[model samples]
Target chain A: MNAVVLSPVDLAIAAALIVLLAALSLRLRLGVERQLLVSAARTTVQLLLIALVLKVLFEHAHLHWVALMAAVMILAAGREVSARQKHRLAGWWGYGIGTASMFLSSFTVTVLALLAVIGNDPWYAPQYAIPLLGMVLGNTMNGIALGLDRLTLDAVQRRAVIEARLALGERWQQAIAESRHEAMRVGLIPIINAMAAAGIVSLPGMMTGQILAGAPPLEAAKYQILVMFLIAGGTGLGTLVAVSLAARRLFDERHRLRPERVGSRP
Target chain B: MPVLELDALATRHVGPLDLRIDAGECVCLQGPSGSGKSLLLRALADLDPHAGEVRLDGVACSAMPAPQWRRRVVLVAAESQWWHARVGAHFPPGFDPAQLSAVDLPPAALDWEVVRCSTGERQRLALLRALALQPAALLLDEPTGNLDAGSCAAVEALIAAYRHAHAAAVLWVSHDARQAARVAQRCLTLHDGRFMAGVPAAEAPA
Candidate 1:
């Protein structure tokens, strides 16, 4: 049987809880009341807009439409990734690296899952392709953002050490090896934690949604496992690519540690 | 022929200057703060973007790989940095602890944590680290700036010995006229982004 659908009134009741949270925040002088309200409004508006777009997307189910939606999602994720950095590489490099890395990792994994694992007819079916790409891209974006932020920040803070190493005849890769490894570890941390705490500590959001939407529990669990593996692989690959590109950008071809290449947010 | 040569090298604030240091010679550079003494040294080491050319032993810096170029021409900045916890970890593999005595450092300094070393100790150790590379040329930016009188003398003697033994070309940056005279064969002062011959050591104002 299909799951019960919630009307606008039901969602409004949920939205009221957020308003109540804002009121409590205001009373407590938490200074987040305005942000809380604004964010809640943003969530409602953004999700609803996407819902409408997805309706049109599902009805068309054309390859080009699916590809266009995927491109928009990847671009938005790229912007978010760069925006999260405290010190980003100057110029298009800051945005381009993260966008390209996420595209390579997320798109490849989603397409592979569709064609080989899920084997959906046409292999680009909106029903399977969209959600799969969304999950992988979203998680990869977070990893890449964290990884790039850590890489740039560390490069700036530890400029002296890196230069000292460089001055001592170490190759660019050798000089930046530690910072790159640290960035990778930080990027993988969220997925590692999620995997460790899955099942016993909490049901993943996707699995819960599937179960609520009337999928059998076993099927939902299987899909969750698949998605988790896909996400882990995507995040790892994306972070690796983004961090490598960013670390290279921190230096010039001459192997100089050009921290000036990374500019602080104005 | 000069072992280390700078021909019209220029950085943002320092440049278009020419100089040469023959093998086994020490040339000290002096300048007022902000007059680009450090910038000149950085350029010599190829640690900063600069215009013009530098050569070691008639070999242009651009001719070799950067790391190879740097390995033969090392820069030890005024402030030393230690990335590893233990002092010895910063040194190259198979480094002899016996060399520490030449810098007046105890053999046990190698076992000490980097944080435990005083500024002067780190400075001396940094020099030893650079010297261990057996660089054909050395770029020293106030190598003894953080040291006491005794430590300074020790560093000078060690550097002098290293130069003598290896016949390395040394470009030493110093603010103290007396130290410059003591360590350098000839001294050049950077003023308004140009190098002028410094006063003879005896004629220099005390």
Candidate 2:
């Protein structure tokens, strides 16, 4: 089986569908006509740019280029995490926690999968390493961001309760234990939902994409399962690291509650 | 010797005043709401950012680790905070069951969920919790504010017993003049950031 290729005329036919959607949105005054058009344009440009870049990187097959791209993706994800936070640590600490957690979790999981599971030739194949790391980083980043944000916000809002524990000679770690637990629970929720719904409530994107590319159903299912497991592990690890680091930042060396260290969303 | 000493301790518009409480001394502190009375207690507890010095038994609060200082000088705020769902979970290991009974709380009070506790129960239970730490000094911020007169008297007696037994320095914040006179050996009123030796005249506002 071979995947179908689209010519310029074939693309025009798809573009016509988008135009109809935008026209209907305009007629109904849904107030999203401009957003729909802009999103369509952005989707086209971004995908094409990434496709071209990936093609070059795959052809050259250089480890340095693959590493650079992964670093860039991690950095962007880190910034997104920081931006999405409602309560965040001051200065670069906000971004640092997310970036460090994602880099550590995604890198370790991706490398382990490549070396032990896939065993691609040269092991650093751009095709496998880049896509796998990207998916892992995306999920892990959201988990870290959510966990850190919840931990910080909860600490600030529950200042009296936390300090009450501290007054009773509880260590800083002991005082914030409940909040940390809650944050981790919140962070892992998305991944848990996806795991629950996958292959039953809906077909996952990767499996569908693989089937579209003519891979056997069973082969695609196997890959999807591996990817899901990697994502869950990466997200859980990242969320835990992020919450721990963020919790440490909320208190000072003196065991005093330092709500000043946490800042409202900018 | 003084058990707790405040040498010109000052916070944002609160104090630059000196005071001393000898061991076993119960000094009642009265001030209007938002008069920085709570802030002063927090400063003494080293829970707030402040200047000057607070010494506990000749050891400077700054010199010791915060947890160490806090363990010795415990501050019970007006609003008690319950971290764990259950009451017993808040206390340290080896917490004497008798402490709960002493505060007029049932021994099974420990088994009740914190959310089910009445405000007065929390206030009294918080005092018991603080006393369990065996602090060298106790800072009470309207600890019995939510309790009825009977419960208030019971809590007062419990605190007096603890102070008598441990010789803990006490700074109890109270708005009621009668309660203050009944509970404290001496009274100190806060007005314009100064701690006056006796209650201020009615014309003098805090």
Candidate 3:
């Protein structure tokens, strides 16, 4: 066998695409460039680290370690949200949206992909389980971040309007309805745009990689559809949880919206 | 029954403080910036974390859900945020953009982006929103700071109307002696993060 193999051209094209994205972010002066840069760097380091550690886990098949890794991912993402919110509020929201939503949504996608899609083994196979779970959970984590950020910030800024709604007999949920819309709009827009522009605008990275590695067009398309659907599922569920939980922090026992922080007096 | 009560309130900036107001009364908190006048208002609203008890009509405010408490007891800051595209978009329900007419705004104001509103406009709109809610108590943090005479008159008239119609208890925070005299029924001065009785206001000068 001559070891008929895929060429490096596909890999080179992918690398170039990433480089262009980095340049575009800088050119646009998108303030979130830090988020993008850090996100990209983390992905690289995480993949490399996972590859080394996963080899051992794959060989030995340690269920405990797999569970532990999942927990670490959830906790780390939760803490990141905590750091941003920063307070007792930072605490409630971090765990509320970050931990509960992240873990619940991630676990849901993981189990579904495991049982129906990949056909889970007795001890979860690291190759299939970790990466697939990661894809769904990672998307959920990001949605939580986006949703919580918008919700918290809106609460701080639009307090007067919120109180007005309350005086008009609106409850926490009703008053927060507008803020929730803001959060959802910000959180879901990026993914919605990607979904809309996919295929026609450009072949997604996952599908393109599969095609480059000699998978047939139909096979790559199936993976693309699968990943996109899972992303939607993860984001939808995760956002709902994070927003609902974050809103809880705004209310007192009599069901009034509590202020996380007020302006400092002079 | 009192509309507002602060019993033995202990906060980050000050010690156990006590304040109370009856229905339809307006209490003014005035001091230099950073004297904790605003902090006291925030504490009463449970906006600032604190060790204190705040009661409204015999119910503990700190124990109530925050959004709900805010609904009934609102804070109108000097600069309140308007997040919508324009002046009219802030209303959650279909507020008949015509309501802006009552506030010196045209129906077309709805189409204008929020970036267009002047500081006075934001302050005015925030007050209008609070009045719209018909809150049981108002925690106003300088509602008139940015307004011109006309805008200020408009707000003053509305305050008088809300006081009459709703009997809402108002806690006004201001740095201006003139504005305090214009709006409040009674005034308390804040110094070193605590409330003291200010000089009696000139007879609500015409």
Candidate 4:
């Protein structure tokens, strides 16, 4: 019961389907034909590049190589988080807060899972560590980005209400409390929906992949459950940290509502 | 000692000026639009970034926590803002119902939804909201800008009562020269970012 290997021609068949979809988009005058084709190309290039990197990484499996890879992954995720924002915190804060929170939450959660739950030898084994960290970081990145985007945009749009509260002598924390909670809720919505719909509404991608690769159904299901919990914990903690830090940055020590600190996309 | 003192207070467009208002005194500030009238009040309330010293009873603004300082020196902005659904939610517990009637609002106004209130009503409620804190100094940015003749008189009378009862120092910003003459102990006009002895309300253009 070994899994059948996919040749280049087999993948080409999948690529042909994408070309067909792009043709349909073009015929419909849906302006997305170019974006669809380009994104499909990017997916092929990016995944193939990562596959090569993973091959080298698996053969070496040294702690240093794994740490370097993790650093690169987190940095890229941080940039994505910043780019997703409509009104990002100005200067370094635009990039730093999301990056720092993702690093803290995803790294801690992945390491804990490796050391205590899975108990992999050397704990930083690239086989276990890389995939787990990638999964957690990816989810955490989305949460932090959503949380931060919501927070900064809300702070700007609700500037008058916030300052009014501030004028009435409410502390900065109290003034921005509702916006913070709202941002956190928005960030967590995706992961919550995914968890709720998993295995029933749709088979989760990781579980399907594992089962397709010939792992027993029950073993793949157990791994999928663990991954889901890890993602949930990582995302929740990351969003909480990112939103809190971003909220604090929206005001100064004098508790003034500094909407200017959150700059709009130029 | 003066209840509110500004020394070299400056924001981007206003001040680096000096002024004082003793307890129970009202100073009317007048200027054309964009002359930084609101900025001055915001600076005094520590709601905007500004330079120089502001003192309440000789206590420097920087010496106290911002919220504490703001609690003692409240600002009522020109346009009122309400975050709660019910008007009562914005008020503190044990707020005097008499204050509502003093502003000509029914006691039941508290239970009304904020969205249901008119611009003038919200303005009056905003003033009451600030007064409920019983601040020692008040920064009123066109507190009656939205009110009719009757509502404006009611607001002025209510402010006068509050000031006398609490010995609060008041800096009232207004465009109406007659209203300034009616409510202010001294009037000053901000021109080119500095205060000048105001022209007589009658002589001054409307």
Instruction: Please report the candidate that would top TM-score against the real structure.
Output: 4
Tens-digit lDDT string for candidate 4 (A1-266) = 68989999999999999999999999999989899999999999999999999999999989999999999999999999999999999999989999999999999999999999999788898989999999999999999999999999999999999999999999999999999999999999999999999999999989999989999999999999999999999999999999999999999989998988999998
lDDT of 2 by residue, B77-99 (tens): 89998877899988878987776
Error of 1 at B92 (Å): 1.5
Query: Can you tell me the DockQ of model 4?
Result: 0.91
Model 3 is docked with a DockQ of: 0.24
Identify the CAPRI category of the predicted complex in candidate 3.
Answer: acceptable
Candidate number with the higher DockQ (1 or 3): 1
lDDT of each: 0.92, 0.89, 0.73, 0.93
Lowest summed lDDT over 10 consecutive residues: which window, candidate 4 chain A? A119-128
**Each model's iRMS:** 0.7, 1.2, 4.7, 0.5
What C-alpha lDDT, on a 0 to 100 scale, does residue A75 get in candidate 3?
A: 84
- Alpha-carbon TM-score of each model against the true structure: 0.97, 0.92, 0.69, 0.98
Residue pairs clashing, model 1: none
- Model-by-model DockQ, in order: 0.84, 0.67, 0.24, 0.91
Model 3 segments beyond 4 Å from truth?
A: A1-100, A118-127, A141-179, A193-215, A246-266, B1-3, B62-72, B85-118, B121-125, B150-154, B161-168, B174-185, B197-199, B202-206
**lDDT (10s digit) by residue, model 3, range B151-203:** 77777778877876788888888777788787787778777877776555555
**The CA-based lDDT of model 2 is what?**
0.89
